[model samples]
Target: MAEITDTALQGTSKSPNTITLQEFNNRIKRLLADPSVMNCWVVAETTDVRINQHCYLQLLEKNPKTGATVAKIKAIIWGNQFRFLNARFKQVTGRDIGNDMKIMVCLSVNYSPQYGLTVVINDINPEFTLGDMERQRQEILNRLTQEGIIGQNKTVPVPPVLQRIAIVSAAGAAGYGDFMKQLTDNKYGVCFYPCLFQATMQGVKTVPTVLAALDKVEQNQHLFDCVVIIRGGGGTEELNSFDNYDLARRVATFPLPVIVGIGHERDITVLDYVAGIRVKTPTAAAEHIILQAANALAHIGDLSNQVVSIARDYIARAKEQLSYYAGNLPIMAQRIIDTNTLRLQNFIQNIPLHVQRRIEGENAQLARQKDAIKNAVAQVKMKETMRLEALGDKIELLSPRKVMARGYTLTTCEGKIMTDAAQLEAGKLVTIHFRDGKVVAGTQSVIKDK
Candidate 1:
């Protein structure tokens, strides 16, 4: 692609004011070397950026809609200044000064007979690059958000117990070691099975290698509870790979929950926002898993304690209830028996007095009839007294109170009457109801007659 420069002196050769092309280019270069044009700002979009001995940049202005170049210029950044300038550019914008970068470069217009015309770029304003980066990042993030990809991986729930973990990182990285130590050998003595799917943690191969590792984990997804990505041991000087749009899309829409620990203390990568969970360092991510195991143990311990305590409390309450029944049962039964006995005794004493009064009244009536028939009256009075005495004895013999008083007793157990001798067995408790009182007794032994 040819550079856009001043046209050659075609008809100016006839004019003496313009000399040969070589002399004319040299004179024009000398004139443009003023204080203002020697080192001034130029805004253009970079096209071809090649780096061998020196950095070569092809700057161009393109039609916004048509994508056709409207203007083009050649630019160069010396190798001597590339180191500090590239570092500063990446630090401020979180990306390298690469092709298609909209930049503001400080350059000097140079015209040479051999090299034609070019711009010698010496300095750049990183602020422009930063603004452009922000704009691009915002656009990508917004598109992802609108497409509803941001929460796709977030919807996958992390398993309650973290045992199998598929890790993507450099195999011998310090970050990986720290994560393993924190997880497998935690203070709680929890064991974790960490499988390493090694990948390049940084540089050009970072995104592709990590994505490949993720794909492998996905293939064996059933074997793992979750996926963890850990990268530490270096600064975020080349962390733009983490913010790659393609990689971010894959991570944000993963089938399983993704845990990222990229070890960046400065700006968060787009991966961090799209991941199911993000931690500052690999060890911190490990701690989060260990905490889950610890909490599970704690929850189980609490439930066990609750069950044992409840059982003990139930047994104690049952014992108290049994003791209450045992202590009050006999006393209540005895009180009822005593009241019935006292009423029966009063009725028996009144019966004898009433019989004596009835016999005296019969004797008085016979005496009044003695004046008419004295001999028959004496015989009749004796027969009547004898009959009354026999009736009183029969009544006394038939009474339940009298029957019990004659060496007979009714036995009951727990308030139920016992009718058979079989009911009187060893270890069986019974109450004996006598004529005057009752006795509660537990059977120590049973005796049977042949």
Candidate 2:
């Protein structure tokens, strides 16, 4: 490097009218201020900015892919133009004037005698940054698609009613406030229970902070029906965190369905594509919930109306059927009464003749029954008397008196009747009984009969 500097100095030494470096620099200033140089726009990345009376920046143009520096120059926004260009940049991008941002600046080329060659940034074009942002978003989306997670949250079924919701947002954000108010005062009178997991929703820390909030929700996923990410209105550039790949992936693959209402109108973030639903604003998200409940309730009401209509039709048909039955009631009743009266009159006219015939038959039957009963009684009594007479004869034959009269006499020694001669002693008094009388005797002699 020193050899190069010395060689360049050697060439300057060759000029006999060697001008001061300041004089040379002053000449270059005259050349750069020409219309052609001053009118050009240059694209570069800001670096090493120093902000004071002027905002001095080192602007670098680098290899887009390799990132090798191709050009570097000193640049400045003078205190006068600083206010205008910074405001314009911020107005378009929702970002502060800062280092590392790709910027397109229209330059007023300058060569300062003391400060050397530099450019004054006269104006900024925010469109270039916006275009780059769109490109980055497309690239992130493509990567997510390739990974097959782009539709992860989209595949998650949105509940018919999301009564419990977990929210990720800054605690004091206007978006959060609007969401709560809209849900609380919904025309449908639907109720929603919301839990806030507060996180920074803008700036570089936004992604990680919101991711942490998501993790908290995941730990208690059963408590929530869905997750909602909300941010207050801001410039399109403020949506960088929502477009961040990690945050987008987290949202895309979250277990619960995610509803995103972060960016302003028409601004699509990568998170929006992967989330279950995307709405224009936080209030819209709340309204969507209300609408869901209202629609379901309306369906119930419609069914009730259908049931009532069917019931009314059935009742009308029944009424018609009853009217037809009523119209025929008198005729049917009279026909039935006429048939019954004819039957009753026929029965009444036959009554006397039926009674006379019945009585004659009954009298004949009674006489026959009386004769049969008398014969049965006479036969039963005759048989019973004959049996009694036979029984009496048999009894007379078995009588003891009749046996005595047949010449069998009873003898007694003293009082008891004796059947054996051993009952008397040789001199004992004895009595004998014949059929007619009793005889007194003495057992004076003993005799043994062979």
Give each model a TM-score.
0.59, 0.60
Taken over the whole model, the C-alpha lDDT of each candidate is: 0.85, 0.86
What's the residue-level lDDT of 442 in candidate 2? Answer: 84
List model 1 lDDT by residue over 213-315, tens digit each.
9999999999999899988845443666787888889999888789999865665778888999888889888998899899999998999999999999999
Full-model lDDT, candidate 2: 0.86
Best by lDDT: 2
346 in model 2: Cα distance from truth in Å? 22
Question: How many clashes in candidate 2?
Answer: 0
Question: Distance from true position, residue 206, model 2, in Å?
Answer: 0.5
Evaluate residue 196 in candidate 1 and report its C-alpha lDDT on the 0 to 100 scale. Answer: 95
